[model samples]
Target: MIRIVSLLLVGLLLSCDEDVLPKPNSFLRLEYEKATYKSFDDKEYPFSFQYSKDAKVIEKKKYWLDIYYPNLNATLVLSYMHVKGNLMFLLKDAEKLTFKHMIKADDIQAVPYENTQSKVYGKIFEVYGNAATQIQFHATDSVSNFMTGALYFYAKPNYDSIMPAVHYLKKDIVRLMETIEWKKEEYF
Candidate 1:
């Protein structure tokens, strides 16, 4: 009986030797609604483009617009300037704005865009890192119309956290740039 009891205790001790570990940390999966786009055609403005219906276009001024994405807590600040022999200045300023984030950005990729048929030409700068602005772009007719846009989030700079939203909005920005239509000189 002593031998049997000792064997049973050893078996019990062996069975209980397994380590108890806390559950591994799990991450939240972020998902956003499917995007739909709408045309932005205001005769009052010199240009028109298509933007995601998910965003609201608030006219900050005569030629300035705030494309607000409420669900994502982000905004695309767009400003328009008549070339008036200041095309170089506008382009330089747009590039300057993009490079301002170089300290925090791992890389700044400038994607050149040109639609010869529409006379729309520009460069879309993609800033990778924990920068305040993840995207910046400038479009110009090289003669009459120039426009610049910058993407900004309401929260602190967290690249990993905001990457999804940035990618989604980046598509929208590219769509807007692709669909840009400059009104006739007489319309201005």
Candidate 2:
């Protein structure tokens, strides 16, 4: 009787099996350090603004610069063009360049900026999706100076993986536009 009762208890304990459950999908959380800004005032350019201290500014040529974010693997290209009495044309070209991404982009929203005191007027484009470039903008005093900037990621344009970086840099871009005031063109 003792042997039979012990065997039955062992069998009952072994039969109490839990069912295997599937887990929900997991996502990779990438965190970046908080950004700090500093004045980017260089005599080489007609305008100056604040940029993230986290990025390295590379001067490609006179009035042409690249703000590179090493940790995010992205670069902001600032290319300057003389207005030459064609402000409308230049504005059209900038819009066209950004629109080219519409094929791959989910949507594009334009945010207009005007600083009457600084005499700066421009539009910042926020692009959504896996497009090659995410943000683009044009800042001009609307006379002698016309400058356009575009943000590109060195890594493939995977929007999901790069969304955090995009949002982080968006603030920097807004700061840049806010502080980008035109200087009196130095006449030689």
TM-score of each: 0.86, 0.86
lDDT of 1 at 104: 97
Computed on alpha carbons, the lDDT of every model, listed in order, comes to: 0.93, 0.90
For model 2, residues 1-188, the per-residue Cα lDDT tens digits are 99999999999889989976899899988777777898888886778888999999999988889999988889999998877889999999999999999999999999999999988899999999999999999999988888899999998898988898899899889898888877777821
Candidate 2: list runs displaced more than 4 Å: 1-21
RMSD (Å) per prediction: 2.9, 3.9
- Given candidate 2, what's the lDDT at residue 182? 75
Model 1, global lDDT: 0.93
Task: Write one digit per residue (lDDT tens) for candidate 1, span 70-117.
Answer: 989999999998888988888998898789899999999999999999
How many clashes would you count in candidate 1? 0
